[model samples]
Target: MSHECTTEDCRNHTSTYLCGRCTSDLQQWLDKVPVLVRELSVTVARLDNVRPAGGGGGGGHQPGSAAPISLDALQLQENLRSVGTDAKAYAQDSRAAGLAWLIQDWVTKAELLVSGPDEPPINHAANRERVRNIAPAMPTRELLPWLRQNARIVVTSMDIRNWARRGKLNPVGREPQPTYHPHEVINAWHDTRVP
Candidate 1:
């Protein structure tokens, strides 16, 4: 009796237990396993490098104390193990589900490692540049006239002050009168006026 291919997603009938097409697909996935494992190993090594030099005992070593492992690192390690196990299972059974799940989990772990908060701390300079790019900074005194001329809307000083109090407008400098980014003020004005 003819048997169907054992690999998931394969529908070919085969005289043998497994068809050649399914066998090739399984081999391709198995080949990728080692590369993924190597990538995960590199991420773990990078995490190790960033770890604190010693257990936080304030320069004194405590007995039975070791450096604390990051929770992210531990999770990545667990994912690596799961991938390895599933890859083996996929190899034996030629089941696409196991390898697909392993790939998805590996991708998640890699993204966490690459994008963890510690690296490339917030860029204040870039933020300033972005604000400048959005609109030229204008003093509150100049802002009211500019808005009336450019935005075709009349805004009172009290309205600007209220926007500042409400956190809709962020002032750049000293109080009593502060500079503002025109784009932000314009957006806030539009938002408030929306019925």
Candidate 2:
């Protein structure tokens, strides 16, 4: 069965975790990580260098800073790992080996995101959500029946109209036949249910 691509704003279908196009994009981005790692390694090494003793220092010139960027780099790594990665952030400045390490770490994550784990569980396919439109928006005609059957709740088209008018449910599909994702409708039903 097909699964909808998880990449934001991308609406592609795939048999794997990510669609082919997204996977290719991720691979291209991953290509830059190694070169960056090499550069950061050099920078970190240079930062580790010590000043020669008595090199035109007559008065006060204590060995400036002991690894100035090292603490910052460690903090940056912690922050980077906390939020995960975004395609847009790849172009941002990165001068620390810590950032490089996180970037390199993405390779494994990319593999997991594009495809399942090396040895997926036996019930992986059964647990996966099959594609049926990003969230499967149903217009009023289809929405009513689906809610009755799946949610086991009664809702009139007029009630749907009122909810839309009152900002209760937002339509995912636009225009004359506005459609709402079933989950949204189910949520509204639950909210308005008495006891």
Off by over 4 Å in 1: 15-18, 48-64, 70-133, 136-195
The clash count of every prediction, one per candidate, is: 0, 0
Candidate 2 worst ten-residue window by lDDT: 124-133
lDDT of 1 by residue, 20-122 (tens): 6655654554455555555555555564544433436355445676544444554555665555433334534545545554555565555566555456675
As for candidate 2, its clashing pairs are none
Quickly count the clashes in candidate 1. 0
Query: Every model's Cα RMSD, please?
Result: 12.0, 21.2
| TM-score of each candidate structure, all chains considered together | 0.34, 0.30
Q: Give Cα-based local distance difference scores for all models.
A: 0.62, 0.54
**TM-score: which candidate is best?**
1
> lDDT (0-100) at residue 48 of candidate 1?
50
